[model samples]
Target: MLAGFEKSTGKPPEELSLPWKGMPDLKTGEETVEIFRSWRPHSMLFNLPNGNSMALSHEDECPLHPRSIVVVDDVYCIFLGMLLENTCDLRSHYGLSRQVTEAMVVVEAYKVLRDRTPYPPDQVVRDLQGKFAFVLFDARANTLFIARDRDGCIPLQWRMARDGSLVCSDDPNVIAEACGNCCTFFPPGCIYMSGDHPLNKIRAITWEDDEGNISSVLFQVDLFTRLRSIPRTDSSANWAGVTTVDGE
Candidate 1:
């Protein structure tokens, strides 16, 4: 998997040399799809949002990924981040504009797969670094998969320590900080997963009340509290006695 990812990305796997033999694996090819679906489930976060987004980051400037598809245990997932540069209707479901739609098309596309894949728990984390991200989960196969844009603007890494635990990183320092070892980077447009992590719990966020008036979601008190935080430059003292006799 790592080798294929390297070839696809045109570089060796982020952490391994010519090959990536260090990654973990659990042979599940022989398992029945129904049995696998009933058992361990995973998540697929192709390019998850960095969670720290900058307002200045423009859509046209973002990196674009070619239309591609990868299969995880016969579960098919595809990625086509945008229909064209800075334009997409994908986010109409979320009430975002075309640029925001194209910008988030990658994320929404991944989420669509993640939701359909039917993984156990957060077994597959389809995290996005910022520029682009996607994920596909196959609860029926206990596998998670992903892909990313070509640019290095986004970050991803993982590492194994003396204890055999796999430590992942979005920031390089996290690996060394937690594992006391150097971290390995996940190649761009590559995939990764965690095996044997039980998914006994899964929480799905659902929206049901768009029917509720907008006022129901708004809190005037909160707005007033925020307004109070603004610095005041003018005062009542300035107008205490400034009125002209003729009111001119």
Candidate 2:
């Protein structure tokens, strides 16, 4: 389970490692609370095969508790966040509510997966304006998606599991407890997808609108050996891969 602060260490809680040997098994309700009794009470636990479990807890500063973790259909997620702007435009595009809150953004995200013939596009999330980190799991597809905001204001961390699954959370200690010095912070401004179907690479393209609004869009495209024909920028070597493209 993702936790806030470690009750004993006084530091942030560790991202709980699932299926690690010797760790106590966590049940859905009472047993889960017993482990985190001294910490926050808002804990959600899901038991997996071979005694593995996933848990998530909201921190003290978060206001999206109780309703933070949601499970609809075969998709489950633990989200902690607040979108900086109203989602009227995004929701309307998806035919959702103009009054939808950021807490419900996961629902829209799920809708994209269900309605789209293929996987959702990266622009689906790149256009989102918010400060948040979430872990989403799709049971039917046996896939996992983890993402954090661009600024990294919200905390998230992860460590690899024995089966190559990512054990991630908002708490570092939870990972440390399971991985024993293997835990590290999850990178900001990125989304991680894992499953039978996965994205190969993430790319960025920049262009200008008729109104002269320079827009940068991040999305996924087919893998290529090398990108040799893109336009270059005036920036020095420090700028590296960032180049500009003219929009028609």
Candidate 3:
């Protein structure tokens, strides 16, 4: 997977050879955690089933870029950047107190949208006014959700390792060192999710109203990197659209 990613992105192995040398094996949770910790000693790491893991650092590496991790109910979220608008309203809507963190609000938002909202997940993301990027995992539902703000305000990149584990982070140099040329920027104005749930589920990616009428909210990036609503019956529409950006 890593090799294929590098090839498709036009990054030759020789260019990445130097960084690839003396680098710890990133496929293991232990080594990956150490690599991230080397960058931010205060970083918190969460190891998931399979070789997947998540690391978050509360310390700001860049101005206005704060990283936070919150687990509410069974949902786990790692958020980078801030919610500059509607935060108070969101807290009120979720019945959360002022003490609740913004990361907590994000998890609540996902819960509401997944379980109750009639709108599609992407629409909810589009309506958010903030410079943010996040990765959410719902343990109970066995789902994964990822999104970035529309303007690409906060940096986010992801790569699939040779062992098929997905890696994501805001630091490009770390990604380059670990994933070589395999990494690609996670597109702005986009959301990547997994599972059969209505919110992020691409399988039929539809919403049913109280009246039982179904409407589609599925979207995909075309070859031109433009986002377009896709029909439910289009089986070819897959999560590959997440990395279908123009440059990569």
Reference-based TM-score of each model: 0.31, 0.58, 0.66
lDDT of each candidate versus the true structure: 0.30, 0.48, 0.56
Model 1 agreement with the true structure over 64-147: per-residue lDDT tens digits: 542333543434344434343323333564455644433344444445545754432222222223344343334354334444
Better of 2 and 3 by lDDT: 3
Q: Point out where model 1 deviates above 4 Å.
A: 1-89, 92-108, 111-130, 133-141, 161-165, 192-248
To one decimal, what is the Cα RMSD in angstroms of model 1 from the true structure?
23.4
Instruction: Give the Cα error of residue 168 in candidate 2, in Å.
Output: 0.8
Q: When superposed on Cα atoms, how far off is each prediction in RMSD?
A: 23.4, 13.8, 12.9
Error of 3 at 246 (Å): 16
- Model 2 C-alpha lDDT per residue in residues 90-176, reported as the tens digit of each score: 676667676665545665666575475454334335656777777666666554556676677776765434433335566554444
Model 3 CA deviation exceeding 4 Å by range: 1-31, 117-119, 196-220, 223-248
The order of the candidates by lDDT, greatest first, is 3, 2, 1
Please give the lDDT score at residue 88 for candidate 3. Answer: 84
- lDDT (C-alpha) at residue 70 in model 1: 53
Global local distance difference test of model 3: 0.56
